[model samples]
Target chain A: MSSRPGVATRARPSAVPVAPARGRRRKRSYVRLVLLLPAFVSLAFVTIYPLGFTVYASLTDWNLFNFGAPVRFVGFRNWIELWRDQNFLIAFKNTAVFVLIATPLTYLVGLMVAVALDTATVGKRFFRVLFWLPLMLSSVLVTVVIGRMMFDPFVGPVDSVLDRLGVPQVLWLANPRTAMMTIIILQVWWGTAYTIMLLVAALESLPPELNEAARVDGAGEWRAFWEITFPLLLPVSSAVFLIQIVDAWKVFDIINVLTGGGPGTATQSISLLVFQQGVQGGNISYASAMAWMLTVTIAVVAGTVYWLSRRWTD
Target chain B: MRRSKGAWFFTYGVLTAWSLLLLFPMYWVVTTSFKTRPAISGGATFVPWVDFDPSLQAWRELFSESTDRWLPFFANSLIISVVTAALASVFGMMGGYALARWRRLGPFASAQFGFLLLGQRMFPAALLALPMLIMFQDLKLLDTRVGLILLYTAFSTPFAVWLLTEFIRSVPVEIEESAMLDGSSRLGVIFRITLPLVLPGLIGVFVLVLAGAWNEYFFALVLTFSESVTVPIFLANQINQTESVGWYFVSAIGILSSFPLIIAALVLQRFIQRGLVAGAVK
Candidate 1:
């Protein structure tokens, strides 16, 4: 994970000399501020300002339907309604299930593929490119191609091959349980590419001496991997896990295109529901409340994982 | 480190199986685009001529007949992605350079400022969708490509700044300091010395931002309506109208829109890996 030693080591504060004159130091600081101005201005306008606006909007009874009507401060009414709403509860459960399942699944599968690629002697580059190909694709494309086309019930290859093999048809996206499964499968499919890329790089960077020493000490391949390689990989593995957890919580594009949260909201994610209420349903205040809830949930979950991983690593 | 023949066999076998599973959807998309409606609805056909008759019907429909529906969206995506990438790279480079060379900016240290920028990404885009819609509505910037370009630039700049900072930090300060000592202005040192050294990192930032904007769906779905619909939004809209539109056509559009990124990813695999690792591991 460290950069090339000497190159990245040069930027420490102690490496640069202190400015001799106070006036010149002040002027230099101003120049540095000028350099950061564009990024600060743009991010403030889009991210920071909108964040504040969402907080304020969540407290008010603002509906796009009531055009020109004066907005009223509802004072926790929307937050109160969120817990009582069944749709919101279902979406929350779905998102929780998604993050819980998809994060670990992606990490494990990515590790397996990364190990496979690292162990293989032939066609390593070809397989790397093939496995990394899905990460290049947009989620919408992945859903349309894989979720819709490949998993289509009647004419899909899965069903066709199943029929040929004399097995009953499994509803990939129609039945409730199977619908969630399909979304998870799609997520894992698209997500593991990132995990593989990171882990492969991590694996390649590990010194061969540890595994070689283990092998010489009469360890089998699996034993060597478990005792030597896997422990060494924990840092990168934790990083990948945290990233996947955050991404899995924001699951939207696939569900939107694949099921549209159909099968009776069985696969509705938090973001999808927020979009449904805030944008499509025009209950901006309520949706904003739900969005803030999602934000808080993500922060808590990510913070917990980060804390746990740090403890485990230490 | 030597492996037994059986171990090598197992490794190759596992990799081969996983590769096929990964390749099947891509294969299906490419073949499905060539299939006709009857050919598609009849059953899964793997071959071109034997299982089904290959045709240009989907391609013709997309490119020739429904040109108005997809082309404008395609153009919008191109303009928005390129402009966003360019703006983000420039802003990110400047921000990154400031963080790299300077120790402080007013009350905050450079590292704290960088972390503040990265914190912007933690909030979900869904959280911003409603407020941005209303904000854009008030500003009369709704449903415009320019609005999307600015928003995407903001969304992409944090990672770009973080990544490019690492890249810029790797450039030894002595080079720039020596250039300044040689009577070159600070701006001249940056342009003539620092810029050339960090050019690869700059391109990495540009490509990453371009791909991120190109693949973005939620913001485009929320911010734009008709004229500024990007490629992913257009494809999603097609999915909504599935009754009239065929999967063949959608598959074609998927292949066409995603082809560029796939090629770029393969071509710039090294730079992309560096950028990704820098973002994740650091």
Candidate 2:
């Protein structure tokens, strides 16, 4: 735990400095920049350069495999064709639906679990670790498990359970109608742990006396939460919500492993489709175009959420 | 105050049920690892425990030349994660301490750190796969463990630095100054004084880095082809290969791959949580 300054002298103060210290700091900022140049360079390569390269790639016919042959520069043909592609359209639609359905559901469940655990008089610590267990397991493992148990046509556990209940033993994942839904369900399971951790942290940070006073005022549990707890929670929830929105944009591994965008591209996420084109199918330029478009769409969608949340919070 | 005992039972029952649901996949993994191929391949009955007795056959298959892909794959992951953890932590601490007290909480510095934090978390990680591979190859770091480590360090360090930096700032400055005034150099002050104080923060950063490296598939998929494959790649291949999908082998690797981190998390839950909340407003 951090060393705190208690009630007295409580505000986190900055380093006080003499004139010499101020001059030294101004000097040091530039010095730190020079010193930290390598880290900055590394970050640029990781974050920025790839962006530039991909953007350039999207505009041209640059296939490395055809190294012997000269590279051709196709204009915005790739982007135009990508927009026209039916599969790409399905992909965009699928990702939007998945995000729309998954986020609120995960938020509700994740918040309930986090808040309940945080306020619990017993097993709070134990439950925190228990809840986070899913997060520790790699998505690769989770996807494999999902691919077997949920997406499998026959002997999938979902169908097995449904069969016993006398419901139709429909293969929800294999069928186009239910494939996206199944993926969405799996996605929720994968992400709930993170939401639980963050929400629990925020809930725990709520001043205890607020709840105590709310109870004293004859406020029921639900009323107190709505009136006091929820309002207090909105900021952190805003942050978490923005983070999840960004996360939804980039999710690739689970979809790649689980469905492979099968059953006539019913469940192909934008990322999955992009990967399929660029890597597997070897349509590098077209894939780059798709990726560029998807990235822009994500930026617009998630960026709006981020901006709205920031505005709401401020 | 007497509520229904039945309702209390029901609440706990539901909680326990949910907890069991959370744990069953993991448990199923462990159990399936012990089942025979026949039992696993799903013939008459799917009960791993009931049909066939325990066997190390799957493990043998995993280690043998036929499935020897995993041997190198696991080793690659181990190297990458361990190296990433070590470098990211050391560099992170240095960077963190600098950020914490280097200059005043000037707007630009704070903005820089904030932007770093947001940018790292926000941008889709997998999108960098193609471009990063090209960059790494151009730099001759492609398909090299060192290349992957550098890339991993690039991504993981920002979060580590931010969190650790926040933790560093939270430390009473007088502690470092006191040590420094006593003929302790800046490095000495950091090593002898600052590090011990931020041990919990360091632990959290390491755990996070390890988790990132372990779970990272995109880079491991793209940057690494032959020699530098990780567990995720290995697992994916196992899934792809039609040579009898051994659930237990996958599960065993899954359990084995994640067990070290999970155990570390359990033991250091207090330390990690404490470190994680280091930057929360007082």
Candidate 3:
């Protein structure tokens, strides 16, 4: 019941009569620290400790094959080797391409669907639920259902329909270019649901009066959307865009399940390579270096997007 | 605002087309679950009665004695996901409440703490997978349900903490203060007053975390092999191990594994939507 705004005064009205204010504040501070300790401890043990270990491992020559060989500090040899490694280089390029193409494409499709949902007068609730369904699905299920079943080049429905239309069957997951396209398509299909969810929420939260005013001023629907609604949505849209970029950068499960990063490493994301080098091939130090590289890349990309978004939104 | 007939037509057209495109896979998976191997391998059949006759051969095969291990995997997923969600939710609630009520803890402000928790999400799981594998090996916790439960809980708690902090902040502080004035302890006030008020948010956190853990694949694949395989790992193994196993069986297992969460999502749609947007929009 403190009168000051935004400040939490721990001066308990009942306790203030008996205990000294300073002592009460100290006790309350202890309580707060105790409450916060579990979360911090768990996160540190799981995230911070592992991150530190990864950093250490990345600098050393640690391999499971050389068991009990006594790990030695290599002074950035692993990092340098990663630079020259063709597989790692390919993975870096593929991950970058996947993020660049998928992020913007997801935003565009999400925006289109969000606009459609927002403007529709009939069955709004039904459509919202239907579109949001994909977001509820796991990546494995999406890959199986969408990638393997529906897009099966041999007997899948997509090829069947194309055949009926007299169009030659397209190799969805066999060819390198088409394989990448299939991955992107699966990403857009699954990722757009989340984008739609965020965008729809943003669109609905917008003040209707601005668009109403624009319409009354004889601006067409598209103009009103672009001039009034779109600007207003910049903040949320930019946030969603940044999130999609970070998420796309972490793309692993779909690729692992759908094509196993196949078509000869054409769809190999950094995560896939990290798994291959570290877990499968027992090259711990090299994979740790790659993992750290992926981490730094995501951090930089996220920071850039956040900085650019602030400028645009402001 | 009113629109012309043409505009309405265009809007509905887009909606209809997108809906079909979005729903086709789901429809295909469901129908494929009902078809025989011949129907699936011969060609794509859009309808059951029109193009091919439907059978429960795949469904029967999934539950039959030959595939006896499917139940254990399903149970493992269920147990691991539920335990992780519950653990994360409880820990996150306590942490979130501490963050909401206090301005600072030691040298860091509550907002900074919240941001630190959220920053955990940005670290790629692949970065942590190797260390966790080595750590779990040392602890002799590899390929066990307890190992997965621990990892999933730690990974999910940050999200829960961030989202629940927002939910906790929405609750007015006056209610708790009044209860404390009436000779109730802080813990009592939290349990009796705040917990009930934030029930919806709690449920939202639980459902979201549960679904995530249920669907988790990367960590499970890295950590588990035989005794503690989850549905995703099992499904992937089924596909990768043999080319002879029919697509219909894979589809049946996929449908079986995915249905529980889909139903939960539909039932708790309102809370889930609110939870989803709470972090993103603000």
Candidate 4:
């Protein structure tokens, strides 16, 4: 034991060692790089390469069917065609309508629910889970269960209630007018839970001082909420706003399952249009152009939300 | 805070109604699943077990020989989700630790790299669908479990990276440095100390990613067809088929498909709450 020399100094108990030799240090860094490489490389291949390919593919007339044919570059033609394409225009309009309707409605309902839950003194956790259950369920299942079983004009519970109430049996999904409304209702019911949970989290995370200060100033609950609490919540609200807009813009699975972009293109969002064109109709490049257009629109909306939120905070 | 009894009643009433409204579909699916076909179609009873005699016919049909495909679809969903979550957790943990510990890149560089990684999730999956499909076609990965696992891992890794990085950053660096001073290698320190510290976060990420991939519809719809169809695809097909198929069966399948995620959401509610706020508001 006494002959075990230099074991203590060799330990060199310090926070971090001043690394030994430049070449060994370089080799250690190479190890670090090797560890990091798998993630970034796969990310690049899966995301970056595909994104670059999409940008390039958008400029060409690449049909899904003609795999063996030479691809032709038709710069800006797909974009130009999108401006005049009736279905694309409808899809764009529907997508905008969905974002506009869904975002605000979800925000208001979510805020209300959040406020309500916050005010309640008991069983908050239970209600939180209850509200979030819809969001947890897959969109595909939500759409299917709601579409086929609950809203079906023939066997649906809603229609059954209508029949009981002596109201007419309206074709909720079959009519062009109600189809979009049905989609919106389904979306709101499915989506509001997430917004509520988000807003609830935001509400819970709020510092108690502001509201307490407002109360000390003799402000009413409503007044304090509007003047102090709401301002503090602007960041979360804007985040939820932007996220909901992006999500509503990307509405595909629900519409695909619920209405299949019909009663004759009534609920056709840009995502559904992309699917129809790219996968179903084989107009790959056209759909790519549409997808890029949708992407730019989402980016712009999110960016604007960030800018506006910053200015508001300022 | 000093509201009167009437105000309390009103609050509770409104919340109860809203909660019911939000949860009605789930309730409807459960109730409908237990109903007889006539009750499903004719009366649409709210209390299936009480108002009418409940039947397990739909449940039986779901597992019967004719619809034996349901079992395989459920298994595929399980396999895909678990594999994707497991793989994403490993890759994300390693990458996240490297990003956290690699001081050669300054703090700003790390932030930039983090954002660069996360920005991959910002773009819609639709934009990349065509290119990805064509690539999959070339690689002969379409309709394969490995293909979906790879795609989901790629897509979900960014989330895992961001989340795990947050977890790793929260871990005190002093612990790691002390471990390093004890002559432990970086890998050893990570395996011995960092991973255990962040195990809860890892479990959170696993559950979150599991729910995500399990609930995913778009890629599963686009990528796989017959041999590798997931639960979502199976349920979608069942619901989208003709209305002649009774609502009980549709509801039963819907309940079955959503059951796992619902459990996850309830069990992992705190993680989800934190994740939602972290991913966006933070």
lDDT of 4 by residue, A1-314 (tens): 11122443355555433333334556766776776776777788778897789888889999978879999999989989899988889999988988898789988888888888888889977887788777677888877888667888876778878888999998998897788888888888888887888788888888877777878789877778888888878888888888888888888888888889888888888988888789777888889999999999999988998899899988
The C-alpha local distance difference test score for the whole of candidate 1 amounts to 0.87
True contacts kept of each: 0.75, 0.30, 0.72, 0.68
lDDT of model 1 at position A216:
90
Ranking by TM-score: 3, 1, 4, 2
As for candidate 2, its clashing pairs are none
DockQ of each: 0.73, 0.42, 0.75, 0.65
* Candidate 1 reference-contact recovery: 0.75
Question: Could you tell me which residue pairs clash in candidate 1?
Answer: none
TM-score (0 to 1) of chain B for each candidate: 0.95, 0.87, 0.96, 0.92
lDDT by residue for model 3 (B232-280), tens: 9888777676556578888888888888888988899889989998867
Off by over 4 Å in 2: A1-31, A72-75, A149-156, A281-283, A310-314, B1-14, B43-56, B59-69, B104-107, B274-282
Angstrom error at residue A42, model 2: 2.0
Lowest lDDT 10-mer window, candidate 3 chain A?
A1-10
**Which candidate, 1 or 2, has the higher lDDT?**
1
lDDT for every model?
0.87, 0.72, 0.87, 0.81
Evaluation by DockQ, superior candidate among 1 and 3: 3
Error at A267, model 3, angstroms: 0.9
